[model samples]
Target chain A: PDPALDDAIRAVIDGKTKPLGALGRIETLAARLARLQGTTAPRMERCTLTIFAADHGIAAEGVSAFPQEVTVQMALNFLAGGAAANVFARTLGVQLRVVDAGMAEPVDHPALVQRRMGPGTANSAVAPAMSPETLAEALASGRALGADGDADACAFGEMGIANTSAATLVIHKLSGLPIATLTGRGTGLDDAGLSAKRAVLERAAARTGALPPEAALAEYGGFEIAMMAGAMIGAAQARRAVIVDGFIATAAAMAAQAIAPGCEAAFVFAHRSDEAGHAAALEHLGARPLLDLNLRLGEGTGALLAWPLLRAAAAMMTDMASFESAGVAGKT
Target chain B: PDPALDDAIRAVIDGKTKPLGALGRIETLAARLARLQGTTAPRMERCTLTIFAADHGIAAEGVSAFPQEVTVQMALNFLAGGAAANVFARTLGVQLRVVDAGMAEPVDHPALVQRRMGPGTANSAVAPAMSPETLAEALASGRALGADGDADACAFGEMGIANTSAATLVIHKLSGLPIATLTGRGTGLDDAGLSAKRAVLERAAARTGALPPEAALAEYGGFEIAMMAGAMIGAAQARRAVIVDGFIATAAAMAAQAIAPGCEAAFVFAHRSDEAGHAAALEHLGARPLLDLNLRLGEGTGALLAWPLLRAAAAMMTDMASFESAGVAGKT
Candidate 1:
């Protein structure tokens, strides 16, 4: 990653009139920005937050509290600029794009990206989520529009009713972590609902075993999730920062990393969310998120919230005067 | 807090097209802002960051890595917008006001507040740092200019070479925590230097047992730290949000809370820093900081990083469309 600029970047960051490493993760993020764009004066003020929307077949398992219809409705909400991610994007001046990977119901908004894989995947408790052909189609749909701009970074988010169940099975297969460790109330389920969900997911995990990343996507991944994973791989290929939202989004990142291997170098885990399995996912990925506020929202809201920090990091590196310039004594 | 509006605020927040607490601490902060300003449209775009600069007597005890002269030098650096805090303030668009409380040497800056308490405090290990008279004067100096005008919020920070030692002793006397529990490397001290610092502080603590908050300030407070505590009191009195920096700033906040009793109602602990004694101080205060990046730079840099979150919170509350407005179904 530009070993020549490494010392220069450190000099710029260290020369800022603060204690060494005092700005903490800001400095880390700053260094990454410099490396990603291969410039100390990197700019990330323009961001594109793409929310991939689809429904999971596992909704039939009664795993999620919300109806599958909420997926289509939320995509419409995002297009209408009324969702949490919409507000956050507006606040951070990010452009929001809601891509329809596959929804049980069709969305009519012109703003919705028309890349439908299917109405929804098959119930993974009984059959695989999708055919390998559809999985590749979803992945290709995301890759086609990768970093299609001069924007500094791109964030990935997903919406699928019962998607958490799909993610649980995906991670279990990927990491060999126990299904019991992976299950959580997706959109607020009660004790009975949670138990019922666990039972259904446990059966799915036993049936699927530990499939490869591609096979696992066909087995348990939602179309929206597969699309997001593809989008991340593409963003990293284009050398743009990939911002992962909460649990479901992070699950997409895990899948992307499995396929692309080094895509995580461009990633920024936005928050250590309180979504049940998120901590485990973060731990397995060896990630330290930008914020940890017990957030469970799934629309890249956390990433939008963290967008300002990127600006701060870039500003500190580029706009801030060095010790040599400011005539401030170096830390001794 | 508006007990009557509590339900209303929740309805508004929960109605805002996000999940229940999906925004996490952002929602919590928004609710507080709404309650404090008595409006959902809380404004924090205009911020005044006041950094109090002074010298610590404990520097003579080999408690810090940097020499005392660095304190005044850093103040000049801050005025020139060369310090980390200056960079952060510029990034956040917050106006910075450097208040020279008591630097060992005078600074010539047109923007600096000329309320000098003294050249420096006495070596409190042998005698009191400041007289009760000077302590009162420092407090009055901060209170008199409490939220000088139109500024929405205030952040208090300090620049003293060995202020962490002063803060440790101050917290020890205020909370009766052990010297061992309270002491830490101020800037960057070696193992021998740390041990020597602990020995000197232990003797000082044994010699002067329990002290009231005022007496603690008179004994061990750096003029910058005392001024910061006073500024916090003033900010709270002005009903402006008090953006607290790292360890030294949090120590000042503890002192302010002890004196004013309920000023914390308007407080926002900026970050859980990586300083040795910060966590203990945070635990004693029961504060949940907005950010944590292993920051120990004591120039209000962390506080500036958090300013956007406040803005994001307010924006979500005011600009976001409710479920009804967005025609999205509520949780049922």
Candidate 2:
């Protein structure tokens, strides 16, 4: 970040018709946008939300409430415009794309972007999630795809069954937080199911010690998550804002920040999720997302909801008249 | 609100292609819209934001940071599409209207609606803010205007200099809260200025003890605030949603709730403001606003920022497909 440019943007924001800092986080958001684009006046008119679908081998361990086939079913739901993400995408006028990173079963659709690494990864309780070669390919594929997009910002959503289980283990390994504390009901697990999830995640987390970002991904990450992290880095490299969704997407953001140190400058966290581990993850990253509607739905819905605030912030910077221009008297 | 309709809406929301209660407050918001509209599928496509601009007599005691001339100036700015409210309204596609409730100076603009109750209220620090007749007319005018609007929802914004002091006194009288607790720096008061504002508000609040809604409004209220309260009631009576803005607007909502006991069914608290007393006032009303971005600007910007969430919530109820229709599996 450019300190001088930041000062200049603050000065510009202070001159707006509203009181100093009256716009609250919006003023800060505008400044961040200006700094990210390296301009006093930045535009964030176009946005795209990509839902990366995959399956987790840990689903066999009964971590999530939904069946493994739900991933493919939901991906098809996205294509059919029947899912919450699809409704939000249509409502917000955000371009929606479904990327098949790797589903457990083969599915063919004309609109699905095929970037499969494999059917899925090996069950992490017994072995690493993906091969080293698969990890590198997933990262490269995500990077190329993210960098090639034309939209000014990219919002990421994931639909991998039991992915929250995978995210919890990744978070535990990266942040060194206790595994049981970071684990929660992925969909709607009963008390007994939650206990089982905690047990499974504990066993999975015990297999890893402190490791690099790539190594951690090979151990416990989902194909969708690794790609999301890579995509965030790629988008940041291309100067596009990366709008991170709920828990799983935030895990991707944490991985992205670990792999590419400065890419967080391009991230705008969408909302605080109701998931058990999300708050800790956000706090670890020092992020204060825009919305906190208790949303735990990880389909870019929260990100999509926050998109207009970004537009409003940009409009406040680019369109609102300064006090002098509005011919309004300033403070006495 | 009908309990049966609420149950039916909850059942419908639960059937959507996400885990139960995953949308969190959004599900509550959607249920509210549906309940208010008396339908399982409620539509909130069109919204209008009306800014009631007036001068507050308490401004004469130097209770606010901005000069009283700002009331007229900001109203003109709104008409010129140069204010934050105008920009937000334009960006969110909400129709923006400026009403001269009782500006100290007459502003003759073709687009500005004149609902003048007089030049302004008397200095509430030592006298009743408005005549009983003026309060009645303001309330009636607001009711007619709010009832006549074509939009599905009406958002209220205010631009009366020193109005926060007036609102503080009103809240203290209505809610029986301590004066100092409900007073804050209006616009942008320095330490000494805030102290002085509190003293003035304390004196104003002391001039009347436990007055009724209309009596309290006459004793310590702005024309803009009184009109806003009436507008809220009028909108609620018409089965239109009332989106209440921050501190001052919320004070109006409180007054409206007092006057028409059940009108809160149509009320949607838009956001919590950064103002010191706003949280107490919101708490007093049992309101949980949608956004909490530390905003204190009062020109309906907070309300405007939250408009999309209402739209999104309504869309979730009306547009999103259920799990059965989407052919997605539910919880195990």
Candidate 3:
């Protein structure tokens, strides 16, 4: 964090409010933003949601019961207004835009932003998957799309079958942690399937060279993860609140923070997902999620569930009557 | 729980919408109200929040670190707009009216409704708390106040130090459960305090006779709990959605349900509380709480936290485009 931003945040904390640190993380986030932007009253406007759609090469590994086609189907569901994400975004009054960074088929949705870097990468078990150029393009696409939204803040969500495997690989590579620590049964995988996922990830890591801050990302990262990382960096530069979803989004956020350390100031962990890896990711990010519903659907549902709390937090900051104004005595 | 109201709720579940049970408890509540009042739309308007304030005699038991005076002080703070509940009510655009059902000291806030039935109850450890006449008057006062609000829906909140013991006793009597099973460390009480609280409740129950339902309430209940029960019943007679808060409100709800079986149609359990007996109370009432944050700090904080989710559920019911309207195919 910048010293000036840190100072500004402390000043806001010391401001004449109801009580010092009564608002919890909401107050902390607001204060940090105040310092970052050099404004006492930092407002959240132009809220944008980036739904990255990709096809995990690991889906071809038979690790998922749901076929790879479910990825495209769900992405279409998102665009055609049938998915839970659609209902949630509608309720939150936030704009939703889809990105086809590496879907298996040719993108057709008019609403979806066609930012494909490849048809899909090779299976990570066999090789280093995506090339550096493809990775760079995916990152650039995320940055460009985030910029296009002119978003005050952005949330990172994904739709990709077998993507949890990809997320595991990314997390393991980034954190220098073993695959066993970060791996989980994605979408109800059995114990055997989990073991298979761990083995696949370990082999993929061996094939890939020294994790090049960004190189490991290209080798093991899904297009959606790379793009989300890019979007996070862009949103951070724009000084927007990056509301992160569950395990996959947290992994992307970790990668984003690695590339651009300043992005941590702009992120808020929306909820503690039921996914096992989620706790590790949140701990790694030093984030406190708003809700814990044991939810693991992973279609930005947890983030959307927490939108009301965010609204409440912001409302408290903006609407609550100060002690002086309400003619009430402060706690002694 | 009425046959007609149950049928109406069933009709709502069978309505032409998404899945048969997708909307969950929301559709049930709306439909039950429709049957009770014989209206299709079943609108919830003129929302009233009655915060019952009292001083717990248990404070004299050395159970609480804070004195009984804090209850009066906080009640005044609520009237003066210094409490968390005040900030929450203002933010949610709900009308909050405070009622001093039992306070040792008189508060001079002009906004506070002076409805004191007595100075305070005797400590429950020794004898019956309040006289039957006082309990009846408290109940009547609550009913009158609720009716005056013209509330299409009502929410019940309470403010009293160490009232958790009072609530625990109510829950034990109402649920016919053992005190040990329901007793919890109220407001960060130690294990020793909890055991002592259970002993106190058992001793109180042993002394108190099973007076008539209303008379029993008067004899054993606090002025605030009795008043809240009356308000809940009144709100039901007026065909309003009664959003019940945590443990204390649940205890009052149980009392209201006992008095007026039809009032069950008007009740909606807002959220599950962190209190040990809260779930038991909810189960006794067959109420499904919306949120379950391990929060035991009453003063309607749980209900306030759930207000946004309630709004979201309502918004989904009213605003989301149906499959036909959005021109989208439902998932097979």
lDDT against the true structure, per candidate, is 0.84, 0.90, 0.71
Q: Name every residue pair that clashes in candidate 2.
A: none
Instruction: Please list the residue runs of candidate 1 whose C-alpha ends up more than 4 Å from where it truly belongs after superposition.
Output: A1-3
Report how far residue B226 has shifted in candidate 1, in Å.
Answer: 1.5
C-alpha RMSD over true interface residues, each candidate? 1.9, 0.8, 5.8
Please, what are the lDDT tens digits per residue for candidate 2 over residues A274-327? 999999889988999999999988989999999989889888989999999989
The collision pairs in model 3 are none
Q: What value does the lDDT take at residue B273 in candidate 3?
A: 72
Model 2, DockQ value?
A: 0.84
Instruction: Name the lDDT value of residue B265 in candidate 2.
Output: 93
Give the runs in model 3 whose Cα sits over 4 Å from its true position.
A1-46, A106-111, A144-152, A176-206, A209-212, A283-286, A321-332, B1-48, B55-83, B90-127, B140-154, B161-165, B168-217, B232-244, B253-297, B313-332
lDDT of 3 by residue, A146-242 (tens): 6565666677788887788888888878887677878776666668877887787777778765585688788888899899889888888877778
> Judged by DockQ cut-offs, is candidate 3 incorrect, acceptable, medium or high?
incorrect
Candidate 3, overall lDDT? Answer: 0.71
